[model samples]
Target: MIVPSSNLTMETELPRMLRAREEAEPGDRFVFHSARARMQHVTPEQLLAMNQQATRAAAELADGRPDVVATACLVAIMAQGPGYHCTAEDDITGALRAEGCSAPVVSSAGALLSGIAALSARKVAILTPYMKPLTKAVADYIEDAGIEVVDAVSLEVPDNLAVARLDPADLREHHRKLDLARADALVLSACVQMPSLPAIQPVEDEVGIPVLSAATATAFRILTELGLPPRVPGVGRLLSGVEEPAA
Candidate 1:
C-alpha cells in the first residue's frame, strides 16, 4: 500500500478486515507492506505533494513482489480533479514496470468508485474527514462519474494525523446527518485514514443502506485483482461478497 506519512488508520483498519478474512479462509495468509508519501495535512497543495511521491512508493512496494499493490488516500487523488485515479494508477504502473514488477495496481480513489458501482448504487451520500472544499472536490469527482452525491458531510479535519485520531464510533452519528433518503448507498468514510471500519456494519443496519469506506473498497479491489473472492467478514457490503446487503 502507498500511504501518507501521517496516515495511521490504513495499516490498522485494513489489517483488521484482512485478519477477519483469515477466520473464513484459513488457508489464505496475508502480509502487509507500505511506502509513505510525505503529508501532514489534508489540503489540496499538501495532497498534491503527497501524490507526487506515489510513483516512488509504488516502486518500493513493487520491490516486495507482492501479488497486488494499492494506494490508501482516496481524496488525495480525487482532489486532483475528476478521473485522476486513472492517471494515478497509470503512473504507478509505469514506476512498477520500470522496476520489473508486474503486480496489479488498485488506486483507492478508483476502488471506491468501483465498490459503489458493484453494489449498483447510483445515488449516494458520503462522509469525509477533509474540509468542506476538499469534500466538494470528492463529491464533484463522483458526480462526474455519473453518480449522484445527494449529501456530503465534511468533518473539517485538516491535520492528517488528527483525522486518524477521529473515533470510528462517532461515524455512527455523523452518517445520520446525510440526506440518506435520496441515496442508494452511504460512503461512511470517503477518506481511508478516517477509521470507519468499526461503524460500517452498524450504520448500514440502522440506515438500511449499503455502507462502505475507502479502506474496505480498496481491500475489495485488492482481493479481486489477485483473482480471489472479494469476501471479507464484517467490514461492509462491498467486501461481504453479497449482492448489496441492503437489498
Candidate 2:
C-alpha cells in the first residue's frame, strides 16, 4: 500500500481486515508492505505535495513485487479533482512497470467509486474526517462522477495524525446523525485515515443498506484485481464475497 507518511490507520485496518480474510480462507496467506508520501495536515497544499511523491513511493513498493498495489490515501487523490483517480492509478501502474513489476494498481479514490457502483447505489450519505471545505471537495468529486450525495457530515478534523487517533467506535454515533432516508448507501468514513471498520457492520445492520469505507473498498478492489473473491468477514456487503449486480 502507498499511504501518506503520517497515516497510522491504513497499516492497522488493512492488515486486520486481511487477517480476517485469512480466517475464512486458510489457503490465502498475506504479508503487507507500505510506502509513504509525506503529509501531516489535511490541507490542500499538503495533499497535493504528498501526491507529487507517488512515483517515488510506487518505486519503493515495486521492489516488493506485490501482486497488486493500492494507494491508501483517499483525500490526496480526490483533492486533485474529479476523475483524478484514473490518472493516479495509471501513474502508479506506470511507475511499477518501469521497475519491471507489472502489478495491477488500485487507489482508494477509484475503489470507492467502483464499490458504490457494485452496490447499485445512486444516492449516498457520507461521514468524513476532513474540514468542511475538503469534505465539500470530496462530495463534489463523487457527485461529479454521477452519484448524488444526499447528505454529508464532516468531523472537521485537520491534523492528519489526529484523524488516525479517532476511535472507530465513535463512528456508530456519527452514523445516527446522517440523513439516510434517501441514501441508497453510506460511506461510513470517506477518509481512509479515519478508522471505520469496526463500525461498518453495526451501521449497515441499523440502516439496512450497503455500507463501505475507503479502506474496505480498497481491500475489496485489491482482492478483485488479484482474481480472488472479495470475501472478508466483518466489513460490509461489498466484501461479502457474494457479488452484487452493478448499477
Top candidate on lDDT is 2
Stretches off by above 4 angstroms in model 2 are: 244-247
Error of 1 at 68 (Å): 0.5
lDDT of 2 by residue, 29-123 (tens): 98999998999998899999998999999999999899999998899999899999999999998999999999999999999998898888999
Top TM-score prediction, candidate number: 2
- Supply the global lDDT for candidate 1: 0.89
Model 1 residue runs over 4 Å out of place are: 243-247
Query: Across residues 1-247, which tens digit of lDDT does each residue of candidate 1 receive?
Result: 9999999998998888888988899988899989999998788889899999999898888778988889888988999999999999999989999999999889999999989988999999999988899899999999999999999999998898888889999998988788888999999999988988989989989998889989888888888887778899777778878432331
Q: What is the Cα-based lDDT of residue 84 in candidate 2?
A: 98
